[model samples]
Target: MLSESSRPIIESTLQTIAERINDITVIFYRKMFEYHPELMDGMFSRADQAEGIQPRALAGSVPVFASYILANPDSYPDEMLARIAHKHASLGVTADQYEIVYKYLFAAIAENLGDACTPEIAEAWTEVYWLMADVLVKIEKGLYDGQKNDVIHSNFKLVSRKEAGTSVLDMIFEPADSTVMSDAVAGQYVTVIVKTEDGLRQPRQYTLLPSAQNQRRIAVKQNEDGEVSPMLHKLEVGDIIEISNPYGDVVLGGYSDQDSQPLYLFSAGIGIVPMVAFLAELKKNHSKRSVVAVHADSSSEAWPLREEYLKLVAELDDAKAISFLKDGEGDFQGEVRVESLDMPRLASVYMCGPLSYMQSVRSALVQQGIPGRNIQYEIFGPDQWILRATRRSMRGNRV
Candidate 1:
């Protein structure tokens, strides 16, 4: 909770701070990187920074956190904090790094606000920053403590690679060292670090694909212009790479209390990775729960892991698979039309895809009488969806 004196000060300055957040974040990154260039080599993505995605995400989150606290002073945003902590833990973020971020972030705020950044205003915003940071640090510590080992990363040797779809490579790997591997739940992800030709190591997170107990598998969607994916596509079977332990909160079978509730798994393009893992887990358990697996792609041939997806659904006792293809044979001829389907009551839903696609599906589901709390989603990159939703809710509540 914010101190009594700081609370009023934050309420007074939050609007001004929100208005200038984008500029503040832009300056913060520029100054931080200029002073500590080594952070760019592995800890941060140069591409996201250059494209301004990282800055915008930060700009969105701070104000949202402040606004939510003012509106509900008794509670913190646990869901948002948990999502962030999981990502931070996977990237090996430490408690000391928050102090470094605080220094640059506030300096940038002061620079952007100029004469308006009074001592009281600065102190209040500082309180907000640490309040959020402290919760994240605690959650990250818990995540680290639950791991099988204390190390941030482990070595994995590529065992085999094969084409799964149009531009996707399904690579399998085994532990290259004696490091203990934690059992990963369905719908979790791991960060893969690759050393580029420029002698710089870069990290990118990928969802763990379903595989045997002794092996780790991931499907890489080759981005010709991407710095990490293209390099990952060229690796040989004997090559070794660094991989982090799996960490994510969007696990299958965790949302609902009833084990018999119907489950809906929705995806688009490469977003099918996590959904496939969920289906495999259900099949392994021989679950009797009703299941609906839906996917959308440009064409039938463009879908990654299509055969495996269909086979898993078929092997289940009460599951069905549906596909919507724009240019090839499928159950539907165009994009997903959620209203056309007969959704079961009390169903739990999980969606992974582009932001626009998931947003549309979620809105349609809500309109069809599905409770908003029943649906959960995973974003492939820096989270922009939560920020958008928070802003929307705040706006609606304003007079």
Candidate 2:
């Protein structure tokens, strides 16, 4: 909740703040990192930071949160907060970090705003920041408490490693020591902290693929430009890596209770990660619910876990798998043709991929009579989907 004084102050200056929010956030991260160099060690992703994605994403989230609390006053945006809390929990972001962020972020605001940042303005925005932070802290605490281990990173030693596909490594791990807890629910992701060539510990999140009870499996796609994934690609069967307990709110196969309704799982490229986990469970349970799984990739050989997902779908009596590729043939060729996709009756749709692709799929689903409310999407990076959609909607309406 926002204070009465802060809500108006926020609403009045939101456009200005939003216009320069990226600058404010970039400045905030720079100052915070300069003062607290240790943050660069593990907490923040050096790659995302270098690319300016994380800063810009946080820039969007803060103002959006303020806007929501100001407008609603009673109920906050549950979906947005859930996404944030899950990422925070996965990255082991602590409550105290919010204070550190506040100190620098406000300083950046005050500096950036110059003469316009009055005492009243400062006080009002401060209230908004704390209110948003308080809600996030509470939600993140709940996520941390719900996990098998209360601690952030536990040592997980690699038990198996295989080349799942081109540029993909399937790594499985068990608790390194008796003190470490190992448990992962399907559709969750574990953050792997790896020591880069420069000895910098970079953290990257990978979806928890299906594996044994005492072990965790994750498929790492080597991003040539990324720091962590390339390093993970080189790991041997016996190597150890620091992994977080699986934490994600997008529990796979959690859409509807009724079996008569169809389930649509859509993915592009490596986005098939979580969808595969859901398909594994559905197969294990011998679920008779109609399932339509669509995957798009550069080519069939390039699809990570393609065989695994297809095998799972094959085992399910009421399920079918479709693949789309740019390199030639499949159920649909060229690009993912959401326009040609058959709309199952009242299908519960789950999609994961690049935000733009997800947006396209969402729009197609809407045009095909699938309710927007029925679609669920999970993104690998920061929770800026809310802002991205807002920008897209604004652009769409401009013409």
Q: What are the TM-scores, per candidate, against the unseen true structure?
A: 0.96, 0.94
- Summarize candidate 1's per-residue lDDT along 1-399 as a digit string, tens digits: 878898888888888888888888888998888997887776787778888886788656777888888876777877778888998898899999888889999999999989988998988898999999999999999999998899888899999999999899999999999999988999999989988888887888899999888789999999888999999999999999999999998988564324767899999999999999999988888788889999999987889999999999999989999899998589998989998888965678999988889999999998888887788999887887877766666665532
Predicted structure 2: clash tally:
0
Q: Write the per-residue lDDT of candidate 2 for residues 211-252, one digit (tens) a residue.
A: 877888998888897778878888887888888888887875
Off by over 4 Å in 1: 255-260, 393-399
With a 3 Å backbone cut-off (N, CA, C), the pairs that clash in candidate 1 are none
RMSD to truth, every model: 1.6, 2.7
- Estimate the lDDT of model 1: 0.87
Worst 10 residues of 2 by lDDT: 390-399
User: Per model, how many backbone clashes are there?
Assistant: 0, 0
Candidate 1's displacement at residue 87, Å, is 0.6
